[model samples]
Target: MEFFPYDVKELFKQIESKPNLWNRSAHEYRNKEAREHDWKAIYTHFEPNFDKMNRLDQKEIGECIMTKWNYIRASFMRTVKHGPPTRRPYVYYDHLKFLLKSDVKAIDAPHLDNNDDTLEQIPEKKLKVSPFLDEDTEIF
Candidate 1:
């Protein structure tokens, strides 16, 4: 199923309105039953005409939404959160800013220990050359 840009934007709005769906620390986020209930509610809201008779259909709907959600999240992380100054912000960056309200850091700094002596103590191993690649070796 194809989702229009408007639908996706509205979907993000829906998720934003419900903290349990987006907030990682929410108790409902970790609760399987609560999470499934929320997804069922979301599915009904977006798919009023469809009937969720089988578990597969519900799972498929959830997967589709998750794929889109992940894409939006990854784009926000790359463009707005970690992008260069010249890079343009993602279209939904403002809509999803609530996601960053928690302890989410924009950029993760690399952990570096400035110990030069430790590097010098390690010896490099010599690699054995493959006999098949050598011009002096013949294949039987």
Candidate 2:
């Protein structure tokens, strides 16, 4: 609702009469009352100039000129993002980054519990050592 102040109508008149009005930077339009009163006139001249701003660098002069406009644009962007956002459930699963499903299954197979066959494949403990005594040195 708020905007910067500039003498657009007077300048427009000056241009109409003099035919050689000097172009000024958008920063010069920092009059609060004038902006509130003559926003339509100001926008009529300035809005088209918005398209010319392809890069952020274009807006950034020495001391941040278009504060209100920038704030409104940022607020609008935060409220209504353009698209569904650049997001993906899975980014990349190339062979170099991770092994295939089959390879993973094979690698994990040894750790997983299987039927009787796999249990039987495990070596059973043949000895249980007493905590007090060493197996290599017997008590004589």
* Candidate 1's TM-score: 0.61
| Model 2 TM-score (2 dp) | 0.17
- lDDT tens digits, residue span 45-112, model 1: 78774364577876777678777877877777566444534544467756766766442433331221
lDDT of 2 by residue, 89-128 (tens): 1222111111121122223223223452222233333566
Worst 10 residues of 1 by lDDT: 109-118
Highest-TM-score candidate = 1
For every candidate structure, what is the RMSD over all alpha carbons to the true structure, in angstroms? 12.2, 26.1
Badly placed stretches (over 4 Å) of model 1 are 1-6, 50-53, 84-86, 106-140
The residue pairs found clashing in candidate 2 are: 5-31
Residue-level error in angstroms, candidate 1, position 3: 5.5
